[model samples]
Target: MTASMTSPDTARIAAITLTFLLAGTVKGVTGMGLPTVAMGVLGTLMLPAEAAALLILPSLVTNVWQLLAGPRLGALVRRFWLMMTGIVIGTVAAASFIAGSGGVWATTGLGAALTLYAASGLLSWHFTVPPRHERRLSPVIGVVTGLVTGATGVFVVPAVPYLQALDLKKEDLVQALGLSFTVSTVALAIGLARASAFTTTDLTSSLLAVVPALLGMWAGQRIRGHISPATFRRWFFFCMLALGLQLLLRHLI
Candidate 1:
């Protein structure tokens, strides 16, 4: 469906704006959630493709910030190059499959991923990757992340957990996620373009949506100065759990 197929009313416009703001704030605080949260909310108001379309610019912009804010970019890239390559390849290969499966598949896949992610976070579950496995596992995890992103327009599953398992320093870890997410967003854009899900109207709306995201990111950063991110992170995951349930219900019903 095109933007012309679903004209945005005042309610949808407002919903979209607020959703991006909230998603961006979460990203600012935790270096994640712009895509997951935005899609969770926006999917309710529009076609899943349209909601995914709206994510392009905001995901790219916010994730760029997340990517660049950390230290030693060159070193990080060197470390994760094989994983990055696999992400690109997996996304490109799976895009057409997702397009054929239709949006319902994407929605369900995203919901399942969010449910698993939130449940894991809520349980405070952690995995440790043995040093021997890191070499073999990184590319596999990267490929999995790319496949999920290709289908769902959300990319915070095995990838995030895999990164956490590495036990990186706080700064390094944040930057690593940023880099992975940045790559994911770029790959998603390519996939959407090939699928013809991203149109000019969506691009315009996506660009316009960037304002709220940046403002929300700023606000979240300010809030970070005042409150503990641990609290925010807990709430964020719970909120994801709710959104995941909603998505599942919508699709199942």
Candidate 2:
């Protein structure tokens, strides 16, 4: 390995730290944005697979914490089993091609996904999934979400929207996001490993990233009561929209 690979320069390290710090804050305030924000920022600096590799440990640890902190693990597992299964299948199926494609199209796809996510949030689009139709749609949404995760290293979009449409109580919805994100993180790790994108160095980097993430989360939590989440969310989505457009243009041009 080259010096650059073995010992990341101070500038790169600083960038990564700042990226995770901001991402963690987003998660802390919104309750679900670490991976999304991190991926978006890091994707600008590295290949999609490399960004995904850096994401594994931090995303997994935080999401697992989110999962365990919630009230209903078993119940949520039972309720979303099929969707989770589909996520695994879809992620595994797409991983090799997406993660190993040198990130040409992967970057484009990530840009597109971010754009869609930002657009949906900014528009405040809401769709209700009746209990009766949820069973049929859940697995499909899970699979699509997984595919998107595989390609972009970001796991939002259809999944979050689907969960929100379920009419779940507030706490349950948070827990559900935790569960789904945990599963997505695990599947993504496995996929990246299989693609040879996640190595020991990547693992170490990811583990270290957890610190800034948690610290940012703490800071965000401290200020959560001061700023309205809705106002923050609106601004956040707008920023994301601009970032997404930039990514798309960068890759496309």
Candidate 3:
């Protein structure tokens, strides 16, 4: 149902609008962080699965814009072919599992893992598999990430560290993330399709929320430059930590 059709609770409406605004703003500034940020915040207000479903279309659309804009697209594809291959395999495998037997335990486990990852970043601990070994290891990362995405709709964390180690330019990093998400989104769509997760109602809700999400991105872009890089990084990690804890608690209790 449309927001208006739902019982008019002014407070609830304002909260959802604000959430969408923030989600859009983050997307505009970072190009790929909206779903991560939005899901974290929205999870507090809605079911985590529902929040993730809501983000799928907008994330796909936003990332498509980035993937088309990046330079060296061909080079990126060539270099990461194995990673992509692994992601496809892993995503498909994990999607099957999710389709068959999804539950609170799986989601809670994902939340805990995400929290640990964020905490590691906060503590400045890094995991490296060495450059010479990257080819072999990269695919493993892809598989893990894909599985996480299949199960929880938040697989970006797995790729983040490896991407950071590449020392790419800021724009390239953003583009790479967008590309990564593009792959995951495709995989997710397939899974959702098989599970019959996308109903007329789901699509209707997703389409209606797109405007708010886009608006939030625009606002976030305007403010991005004003914030320091370090501050942004810290805030991102903090949000991750908070999101993880909340998810854990939700499943536990």
For model 1, residues 105-125, the per-residue Cα lDDT tens digits are 767776787888899999999
Q: Candidate 3: which stretches are off by over 4 Å?
A: 1-5, 8-16, 96-100, 127-129
Error of 1 at 246 (Å): 1.5
Better model by TM-score: candidate 1 vs candidate 2: 2
Query: Ten-residue segment with the worst summed lDDT in candidate 1?
Result: 94-103
lDDT, candidate 3, 132-237, per-residue tens: 8878877988898888777766757688777777767877777777778788777776766667665567666666667788787777778788987567767877
Report the candidate with higher lDDT, 1 versus 2.
Answer: 2
lDDT of each: 0.83, 0.88, 0.72
Residue by residue across 58-166, what tens digits does model 2's lDDT show? 8888888889988999999999999999888888778875677745788778888899999999999999999999899989999999899988888996899999999
| lDDT at 144, model 3 | 86
lDDT of 1 at 134: 86
Kindly give the number of clashing pairs for every candidate: 0, 0, 4
**Clash count in backbone of candidate 2:** 0
Name the runs in model 2 displaced over 4 angstroms. Answer: 1-8
